[model samples]
Target: MDAGALAAALAAARRRTLSLFDALAAAGYDDPARLPRLSIVNPPLWELGHAAWFAEWFVLREATGSSPGEAGGASLLAQGDALFDSGRVAHAARWTLGLQPEVIKSYCGAVLKAILARLSHAPDDDAALYPYRLALAHEDMHGEALLYTLQTLGAAAPVEEDVADWPAAAGEIAFAGGAFQRGGDQSRGFVFDNEKTAALLTVAPLTIDAGLVSNAAYLRFVQDGGYDDPGHWSGAGRHWLAQQGRQAPRYWRRAGDDWTGIRFGRQVALDPAAPVRHVTLHEAEAWCRWAGRRLPREEEWEFAAHSGHPGFAWGQLWEWTASPFLPYPGFTPDRYREYSAPWFGSRQTLRGASFATAPRLRSPRYRNFFTPERDDIYAGFRSCAL
Candidate 1:
């Protein structure tokens, strides 16, 4: 990309970073004293601080001094690392923490101001450039996580003033598989270290749904007793389904004979016509099997995603893929060792974006992962013919 282009993209990204935090502040962190069960969505205060601190750590610290605020900000981030870092704690503990909301918000505000000041100097300096890119992208991801967290916590739907109409569903496009490029091409501007390289993989002929699996389609599975059939689930998935007594999608509530789902903090009629959100890999796979279809593999998912419209609604919800979340050939961890290495082989990968995904954060090569048993994520899947 040209210098002028880089400057423009970075400027656009910076604006998005601020907007993301503003949205978080509006999400209203629940009163800690009156909190509910533990979950991955922490109070908005904690989220705000983490977002700012991540930017500060990567951008400001490297640009000015390694020490956060001349005294090392690690203390502020220490106790909460296991709680908020995606790589550490279980997703369910976010709601159970005892953090001081006011302090977190103030600290986050301070860090944001500092980082902005540092950005004014050298917007494209490599040290400033790379980490700034990482920080913005990182915040973009957390923005999506924060959205899912809101749904998990039953917080109010994000107050989107000009809520763009959901894209007219892109009818599924047909892809005849052959040799295809998988993963990121570094020539593009900033991508996560995890998505930095490309690999060649051959794909078999298959047909993927024109669009993501719809809630209406998933409801058919529910109506058909998809959740109760062991034949429909993997062994571990079946075990987990039984353990959780899951009878429907994670947030759905049965009222009399109808189904309602929580959206943006309000319970509404489950839109059967809309794509299903918040499903697990097990549920996705089971649904596919019951329908005589199979989940698309990771390569197929990427091929379809990139093949589709460039700016599709990918950031709306994490789309499930048939592939496990493992490193590409010869994958190397950049400075952020904690980003992707630890979770390798342990997590199944998801592609596409969700409602909470930051506009700046996604690409064809982005990889999202969760354990097979995890059902609380902002995830759903698409299917392909055998």
Candidate 2:
């Protein structure tokens, strides 16, 4: 990338980060009393500041040897990578820390302003350019997480009013398995550290779905009593269903055959054409079984996605993958060491970006992970042909 293009990239990234914050503020950032307590959705005010701090630390401080600005920068910005990172910290204690929202906002503005000023003068430097790109992507991911958090809290919905939306999953990609390398090529401008290393793996010729599962399809599972049938569910899935007495997808309420869902603070008719959102892997698995289908393994999912389908519009929705989230062959931790390495073992990977996902945030190689039982997330699933 030339100096002009690099500058444009930085400008665009800053603009996007600001826009995401605008959306969050529009959604709500009033009294802390108004928000839910102990939810993984919103890290406390301090955490938000810390997240911004990280952007500054990696992109500016480490990349360019710059110091964080005044304001709330000193209070929330921690030295090194110890604090503010979810991968390193215990999830539950995030809320216990007292962080004022106003201070957090101030810190965000401070770091943002400082970075913008520095970028205005810094000569064309790829070392500076790369970290800035990474930080922007990191912030974009957090912005999506913030939207998911809102969905969990029943606070708001993240819908892009303009672009045409994704249709439900209709079919699969027929792949003739060969020596397929399964990670990202850093040669493509910028990417997350996790997707950096890739290895060759022989994959079988399999047919994978074109899009994610839809509400109409999930409804069939519900109508057939798929949730009630123990045969369709796995041992853990059945146990989870029994514990919650789950009869329908989370966020859905049924009245007779008619159904309404709480979306974006209001109830709306379920759009059958749109892919079903907020479903767990267990639920997705059961639905697949009932339909005489199966979930695609991670390799299969990536193989299908690598072709770059026009059907995909980043930030529209997250597509669940059958594969467990793990490290690539030569996984090495970058400066943001704990980001992907810590959660590699058990978390299941989800592909695609949701409507809440920012445009530049994700790519085919990006792997998003969560527990199999988490339905509150803005995630959905696709299937493979048996």
Candidate 3:
């Protein structure tokens, strides 16, 4: 991207970051006593500080800073490593960081200003802009996570959903699949290392949903006692089901004869026509079993997406694919070495983007992954005919 584009993106991303942070603050999440103590989340104050610190560390520090703000160079903020270094801080420790909300916000504002200042004169080249994209992508990931955190905490968030006038979801689109590139090409401007060095994979002919499975479609499974019948679930899924016995989607609750789902803390009636969100992979797979269908493989999903199926809709929620998150052949980590190398094999691959996903982060090739049992995130699935 050009310097102007990078600067604009940084500014917009900062606005998003602050908007999310402000929402959480208004909900009292910024207070240490009121902050959530979940393993899947970090304290809001600490989270924002780390995001800003990351930008400064990657973009402003001396090129040879081995240990963050150590022998390499001094940080823009005093005790930066002691306060916000995620590499050294454990999950539980984030809550005890004792950083005040205003201090963190000030730090965030300062770091963004510094980044924009540097970007104005920076060379408009990929190599020079790598750090800027890296920081932006990292913050974008946090922004999406913050949305889920808001949902998890039942905090009201202002979200604009673009699901209206979506493509028709009534039928299936068949593809006569063949050998195809299964991941991101290294030649792209910016791509996660997990998608690097696109590899060839064999995709069998299959028919997939024209759009994601809808709330009404999934509701039928629930009404048919799909959860109680363990026969539809895989062994691992059954184990997960045993631990957290649930009758419906995680965010759903029965509303008299119909159903209601919590959207950013608002108890809104479930949109039967809208694609179901927050269904775990297990829930999706069980729904597929009840319907005599199967989850689409990641490769097949990608192929259909690239096939120019005008009705093959997405970007409503992250769609679960029957694929594990693993390194591709010749995969190499980018500058942020810890990004993709750490989480492999343990999580499932999700294609497409969620409603909370930033426009810059939404791409067909972008891979989103999470543990299968996690249904707090805005996610759903489409299926293939068995």
Candidate 4:
């Protein structure tokens, strides 16, 4: 995109983020006590500051070298590197940081203003636009992170005012899988570094569930003691289960024979037809085993998504696949080096988008990754024929 367009996009993204911060502050989520020291949940105040600091570090400092700092060459925030640099700041230490919401808000505003001013005079070339787009995408990701963080804290779900009704039922879709191109097209727009180097891969014939596994379906696994049955789980999954003492999906509670889940801080009966969510890869794997099915490989999920086959539905929740996160063939890191390289092998791959995902980020080839044990994100699974 050109400089003008990039600036506008950045402005819109900042607005969305600031609005979320406003809501979080109103709900007292900015308080450290409200957000625990979980690896997945960043303190609300720290998250806001980090977003701003990142923008300044990339767009204004690294790209333009005109940002406010020592000799006007470093972060505008004096202690930004110490407090907001995620690479340097430990997850558990975020809670102990003395960050205030109002101060973080000011930092965000100042950083955004500086970026906009720089964009006005910047060239429309790749060098100038890359960091701007990168910052925007990074903030967009953090917006989704904030949503999941809210879910993790049992806070009210974000209001989806623009979301349309999704098709509720779509059975398994069959595919005569063959050689298919995987990853993304960088020329299309701003593609993440991980999605670069798109390559072709051969896939075998498979039938994948059109819709996500539902609460009723997963409940069957729970009733059959899938959690307790060691045969259904991997050794690592069993270890995680024992460590966490998890009985069901996070936020799930049993009342006698029925199940209820906490949605937006309200206890609601499990919707049998609704897609089961907040399940880890381990839990999804166990449910698939109990049901005599298996999670689709990442390639198969991408094929189904691109095929446009009838009864094939997605974008409800981030669907876990039986694939580990890895670099594509000839993979090269983009300008934002830290985005994908560090988490390559340790995280599992999730395909499609969740309801909280930004519409622009929801693409068939867009790959999301998380650790196998993370269940706080809005994640679910669909079964494939074994």
Candidate 5:
């Protein structure tokens, strides 16, 4: 993106950051002393400051030859590196950091002001604007995480735009696949390090569902004893099922005959037309097994998304792929060393966007990932014929 587009996107992302922080504060996450310590979540005050610090680190510091290694400049926040550098700070340690909400809020404003000031003068070239783009994407990513955190915490949630891309999983689409480009191009600009390794891969012709599996369909699996049967589950699925002790999707509850899902903090009837969300890869796998189908390999998913199938739909929720989160052949770490390298082989790749995802971040090439056991994310799946 050019300077103007980057500036506008950055500003919009910062506004979203502040709004999520406000919602967190209103829900008492600003003081997390009473909250249970979950390995999956972050402290609200730390996340607020860390988001700002990352932008400053990327746009204001690294862009100026101050890498994370070399001594560059002092942070606007006193002891900021000690406070906000995620690599330096451990997750459990964040709770004991003794940060003040008012102070972190001030730091957030200051960092954005500096970030905009820097972006105003940067050259419009892709090389020059890469850091700004990274910062924008990073904050946008965190904004989605914060929304899900609110949902996990049962706090107030953001007002989302309608994400109904289609009425149902409009049957299946057959793709006679051959060579497919599996990753992003540098020319496209702002490609993530993980997605930058381009490869023309040959994939078998596959048939995949035109739309995501709906809540109604998944409920049928639950009612049919899919979870209890264990025969439909993989070993990992069984382990996760036993660990979670779950019979339905993470947020689901049944009242008499009707199934309701808890979204954000409110419980509402499950929408038959809407994609099933907050489901783990294990659950998705079990459902696929029950239906005599399989999760689409990421290649098939990429192919199908680009095939221009009029009935195909996505972006209502993140869709799981059968592929594991492995690096492409020529993969290398980007400036942010920990972003993709650390979790390789351990996480599952999710595609598409969710209602919580920012519109600017929505792209078929964007690879979302998480541990297979995580049902806290807004995720679902569509199946492919075995």
Candidate 6:
């Protein structure tokens, strides 16, 4: 909660978000017609405005006791809440919101200016900096969302010239049963409500994959008619398979003896060494069943990650786990109550970060939740010994 450092980080995050918007605009992905009617993908223009609105609402308005949408409130935009309040705005209606790119940019700029001005005079205490940190974290999440949205739309990938090459780790790593703490450490600063109330849990002796499952390995599942067999799928998973009529990962396609995938709109030959991306929890579970393995529980995944076990590679793709998204034993909602409580029972938990994840926002302790059927994200999986 160092105000100066946090301000700098917020500025950098906003810049990255704007750059992504510029890339999407250049590729004509800004057109409403280009986006699918999916709940997961938000309109780029609306998303930009919403991110700004969230910052303005929390930092400038709510933190100061002014209602967000009231006239004579602190919001810079007259209709900011009406245009971008995600809770009230229906997902299907975002595409038709009629927000212009320039207007959205202006709103974002104004909001950032207001936030920085407040930060300059704000105290360095946790109470004073909590809202600003929350806003910054919110923006970072949206930035990652934008990248995955580009993937969903088949748009060109953003150029990352400085991305370092990470070779996949080899072999399974074993861990002995022990008591391990699960959930965020508040002393480390700015954790989401869902990650609160750290508790110790006993873990069983287990062996887990050192790296994520690769595209070549997933290809074998597809070749074996994994999708057609109900034996490997859960009841809900089988229903999902029937509804989507899916045979493989969302972007994958086959030609003769070879396989290729759509990456940032361009079709490229599948890399056997690369971690498989865009697979659902259902698909991951089925693959594990096919191989006579099982997806690792969230605690096990966290244990391996925190222990820094040799050859345990992550931060390439968001890895799915066996655990359901639920609260820790003594969970209590933070000031921003809506963040995690709503999605607790229905979604599956994902551990680790993806290449598109902002480095500042990632940690082994961070918990990401999504429904089991969501495969559009840059997500993959690893397995444990049965």
Those runs of model 1 whose alpha carbons end farther than 4 Å from true positions after fitting are 1-31, 37-39, 63-102, 123-127, 161-172, 308-315
Quantify all predictions' global Cα lDDT against the true fold: 0.66, 0.68, 0.82, 0.81, 0.85, 0.84
- Across 1-386, the per-residue lDDT of candidate 1 in tens digits comes to 33344445555544454454455456544454444546454555556656766665665555232322432345344464444544444545555566665666665666666655666676564544676677667766666666566566655543562233253254555567777688777664665666657777787766777667777788888988988889999887888888888989887888897888876567777776677877878888889889999988878877766665443345556778878877777788875667888788888888876655655566667788888866667777777887
Provide TM-scores for the models: 0.81, 0.84, 0.95, 0.91, 0.96, 0.94
TM-score, model 1 to reference: 0.81
User: Best candidate per TM-score, number?
Assistant: 5
Residue 359 miss distance in model 4 (angstroms): 0.9
Clash numbers, per candidate: 13, 9, 0, 1, 0, 0
lDDT of 5 by residue, 138-210 (tens): 9999988888788899987656522333455668888888787878987757899889788887878888898
**Candidate 4 versus the native: TM-score?**
0.91
In the range 1-386, model 2's lDDT, one tens digit per residue, is: 54455456555654555454455556564344455675456553544665677776765565332222311334334442344645445666555555666666776777776776776676665555676666766766665665565556555433442233467756656767766667777665665667768677678888776677878888988998888799999998998998989888888888677877777556777788888878889999999889999988877777666756664333456777778888877777776666777789778988877766666566677788988988877888888788
lDDT at position 355, candidate 6? 88
In candidate 5, position 252 carries an lDDT of 91
User: Which residue pairs collide in model 4, if any?
Assistant: 156-264
Q: Candidate 3's residue-wise lDDT over 1-386, tens digit each?
A: 67798788888887887888788888999886787689877887777888888888888762323254333566778898788777788888887767877777888888889888888888877778877888899898888888788888888785542233242277888888877777776674777889878878788899999999988888889999999998999998899999997888888888789889877777887778888888899998898998999998888888888777798888888999999999887887766667777889999999998778989899888888999999988788999999
Give the CA lDDT, 0 to 100, for residue 85 in model 5: 88
Model 1 whole-model lDDT (C-alpha atoms): 0.66
lDDT of 2: 0.68
Over the stretch 174-253, how does candidate 4's per-residue lDDT look in tens digits? 78888878887766467787887888878889988889998888888888888899999998999999998887898899
Ranking by TM-score: 5, 3, 6, 4, 2, 1
